[model samples]
Target: MAYKARLQEFSDTLDAEVIDLKKLRKLVFNGCPDSGYRSKCWKLLLSYLPRERKHWKTELEKQRNTYMQFIDEMIIKPGREATEHGGLADVTLDDHPLNPNPDSEWRAYFKDNEMLLQIDKDCRRLCPDFNFFQCASKHPCSRLCGKNSFETLRKRVEQTVLQSESVSRNRLGITNMSAVKRKSSSEFVPLPDGQEAHWEVCERILFVFAKLNTGLGYIQGMNEILGPIYYTFATDPDTECEEFAEADSFFCFTTLMSEIRDNFIKTLDDSQCGIGGLMDQLMSQLKEQDPTLWHKLQEQDLKPQFYAFRWLTLMLSQEFPLPDVIRIWDSLFSQEKCSTFLIKVACAMLLLLKDDLLRGDFPSNMKLVQNFPYSTFDVQKVLKKAVEISR
Candidate 1:
């Protein structure tokens, strides 16, 4: 009975002509019923789509088309052919890869490769316990169908693998050079035509994001953050919404990063808005809520940085499994101030584990917080406790 009542509430909130965002947020604070509801709610919560129902189609089309333009301009390398619309005419002699000029596109492309490599590494290993990211998407990037010249990131990775003969490494402060025979070119298999793996889509979105935001380009744990958002949208039941999940995910992620970019910027680490400041806020909440636990942590020198750094920065994505992370995000995104409320959630986690935390010393408590006991964890209880702490 309660479930049906909650379902009706969400249906009413979402079905309204112009959504009452406050009502929607309150309903979503508990978590969406399924991916279908979650998909629409996340887009609305992230401010990717406006509240007006009539404008949804136009807004989606406009933003999606703009995203494709970004892919065309940024992802695809320009050819040597002269086109009617500024091709060779725009090229300068100093624009080659070896050119010392800072403005060279080739130079920027190479730098982007370095960032792409890191993004690929992190994304490939994303949520190892779950096979969702590894599975091929039912609805791939159909928008990229005709652009055969454009290289998918998977192909780029295979090409890189085939080209590299060996890599140098340092072991125990000693330079070790060894011949590493990587897989042959023939060993690599390609995905079926018109189909790309889910991780590839994630990699492409992050790459585009890094290109657009040059200031704080491609931080490592961003893959963890993007994983849940992409999963929610990509798994959406609406075929139309699922089809353009990539573009939608990109815009939503961009909006989200704008709010948390300060956390990723090192220069602003100690600033009030950065991750350091966020952890400090978490510690303060801990002290106020459970002084004994907080003081014991202080006595054992269990700094928040040792554990809460990843929690606060990644919004607790690392501490929990994918499903729990999504549920937690439901609560976090629904709030007016997600980051500020995250401090309360962190406090809630400590208060729930107060007995263990207060009894243990530094090493045990550190390990406990670093690798959360997800096996017995309850997402709803933690969130309910988080609300209590907030009050």
Candidate 2:
């Protein structure tokens, strides 16, 4: 489809209105009716249409099952082959060996392919980019919360959080790994009052991730990557409460993930094809904008991929504040040509930092490169520059 048409279609389907978690919760859980556009778009995007409003549950199940089958057939089998050439299989796992069964037929498959099913399993559980659980009940539940029972609590909390009027405006701030670890250890051990609800939202987010990209599988750090979105989706009027509105926020998030899955998958591929392409483009642009700096970087053998991998993989999730990340994601998903937009944004960042980067020595340059989005760089301005460059 033409980009404009695609954007229009998507906008029409999504109604181009900002979704509120409270309204979504009521629509999703309270048996509140959906507008025709919402119902139509939901079915169109999910590729499942129910004959009656009452049949949504059955339809959802069928959609989930169909999605799983598609992954098993189209993504997993093909991915296994594509990854066999020391591709995705080479990544080591800390937990367990790949395909422990020696005599099983899967072993033969693994030996020939040089693939690790265990890593695949880990990807299914951890990667926020791939949605592997759409067809199966493979998510880990807290042993403390009984199986699937937490879902009920989650729904209730979502409703309460969305409807309450006294919710705090304080955003969850980002702290360094050390600080987070110390705070986590010192925090009260008792499950927060809405712990189940929080986890429930996480579960749903995982489910959506699995459904969206079976090839990427689940990975660790995804929960952290998705934390702000979960909190935003569940934020309610009550200061202490968290709630989920219908599947609206979830689906909206699903759309955003769909837009960014390629960048996420690039992290897993040792080939770094996407990152390499971006690096090539960045180098070309750098040469044009600042030949001296570009030549210096080349002289030092400092490839863009060395430092920019995290920027591409996590969409700057680790480097930027959650609100800024969310803004970037919003622009990415809202725009029809997000992939190109992302490339341009990356270029803009490099260009904006060129002066500082050129002044630093190799080791210092590496450190400064690691600390991107430096004090002088404005993310929004960079984004605008990217959009223009992309155009």
- Best-matching candidate per TM-score: 1
RMSD of each: 4.6, 14.4
For candidate 2, write residues 1-391 as lDDT tens digits: 5555544544443343433333332232211121223333333232333334456557555544443333233222211332434222323333232556564434443342222222222222332343322222222223322322222323322222121113232111211111111221221122343343234445444544554555765444455555545444334333211221223334544655565555556353444355455556566776876688788889888877666666665666665665566556544533344455566667678777777777878898887777775356766777777766655
Local distance difference test, candidate 1:
0.79
* lDDT of every predicted structure (CA atoms): 0.79, 0.45
Writing each residue's lDDT as its tens digit, candidate 1 over 288-377 gives 998998899899998887778778778888788888999999999998778877988889988888889888877899888877776765
Residue 275, candidate 2: C-alpha displacement in angstroms: 3.5
Q: Which ten residues in a row have the lowest lDDT in candidate 1?
A: 169-178
| TM-score, model 2 to reference | 0.50
Q: Which stretches of candidate 2 lie over 4 Å from their true place?
A: 1-184, 188-194, 197-200, 207-215, 236-273
